[model samples]
Target: MDLRQLRYFVAVAETRHFGRAAERLHMAQSPLSQAIRQLESQVGATLFERTTRRVDLTPAGTSLLEDARRILAGVEDARRRVEQVAAGTEGVVTVGATDLAAYRLLPRLA
Candidate 1:
């Protein structure tokens, strides 16, 4: 549903364990589990097949995995581009000329 829930889903999908995903996310196990449950409810599908021994993805989960990854990657790319443009603005430019032609060009630019 939301980006936070999507991130939680991806973490769980990658780790295949709720506890491990929680640890990696620096959150408690219960909250992580609750979030996953909430996400499942919102999506109206069980994304993972969980058991005492292991966790695996359903067909729907597999489909969502690719989409979630692309969405997250795109958001990160957009953030980096914005940061780069902002970083570029914190600067100055200078030009030097040793001949009359270059000096004339500079004046024309002004």
Candidate 2:
């Protein structure tokens, strides 16, 4: 439901261990568990199967993971594009010249 939750989910999915995921996220394990619980509630589906030994993704969780990846990628792309535009190097540039001009002018320009 939130970016934090998505990030938390990704960490859990990657490590398949709550304690490890929490350490990687630099947060307490309880909050990470709570966030995952809240996300499951928000989506009306369990995201992970938990046991004393390990954690695994549920079917719903696997599906959501794909969507989460796409969403994160889009957000990253938007940020990059915005940064590039702000730096004045984001748009298309067109160069035109005749073959004869290329033989003469291109060398000079170079």
Candidate 3:
């Protein structure tokens, strides 16, 4: 549903335990569980099968995991692009040369 929810879902799905995921996420277990519930509700599917002893991804969760990964990767790439542009390094480079320098020195610089 949200980035935080997707992060929590991915962590839980990978770890297969709410407590472990919560620990890895540095959050309390209850909120992590709540976020997964919210995510499943928003997606209109159960994302995991839970029992006393184990947790497993539902088929929908397995499929959605790849989508979530792509979504996150895109978001991060966009952020990085913005940061690079802000830092004046978004594939823009400056080269200085003089007419005489080009004849004798530019080839060596290259």
Candidate 4:
């Protein structure tokens, strides 16, 4: 559904352990469980098959994992592109100056 839910789902799916995912996400386990439940309800499918000893992905979960990864990657790419545009760069930059000027300005630029 929403990006947050997809993110949480991806975290859980990757780790295959709710507790560890919660720790990695820096949140409590209970809320993470709830969010996953809500996500399942929204999608009308069970994403994981949980046992006392292990967690496994259902067929739907596997499919969602691929899609979620693509969506997240696209989101990150978009953000970086926006940053580059706002920075007044379009994939390239060139600076020309005398050797002495370049050496002198490098430190200040840094």
Instruction: Give the per-residue lDDT of model 2 (tens digit) for 8-99.
Output: 99999999999999999999999999999999999999999999999999999999999998888898999999999889898876789999
Q: Distance (Å) between predicted and true CA of 10, model 2?
A: 0.9
Task: Spell out the clash pairs found in candidate 3.
Answer: none
Between candidates 2 and 4, which one is better according to lDDT? 2
**Runs of candidate 4 exceeding 4 Å displacement:** 91-110
lDDT of 4 by residue, 1-110 (tens): 98988899999999999999999899999999999999999999999999998889999999999999999999999999999888888576777778887889866886
Q: What does the lDDT read for residue 90 in candidate 3?
A: 84
| lDDT (Cα, tens digit) per residue for candidate 1, span 1-110 | 88888898899999999889999999998998898889889889999998998889999999999999999999998888888778895345677776885777867977
- Steric clash pairs (candidate 4): none
lDDT at 76 for candidate 1? 94
Q: Could you report the Cα RMSD, in angstroms, for every candidate shown?
A: 4.9, 3.9, 3.1, 7.0
Candidates, ranked, lDDT: 2, 3, 4, 1
- Model 4 lDDT, residue 54, Cα: 80
* lDDT against the true structure, each candidate: 0.89, 0.94, 0.92, 0.92
Clashing pairs in 2: none
Better of 1 and 4 by lDDT: 4
What's model 4's lDDT at 20?
Answer: 95
Clashes of each: 0, 0, 0, 0
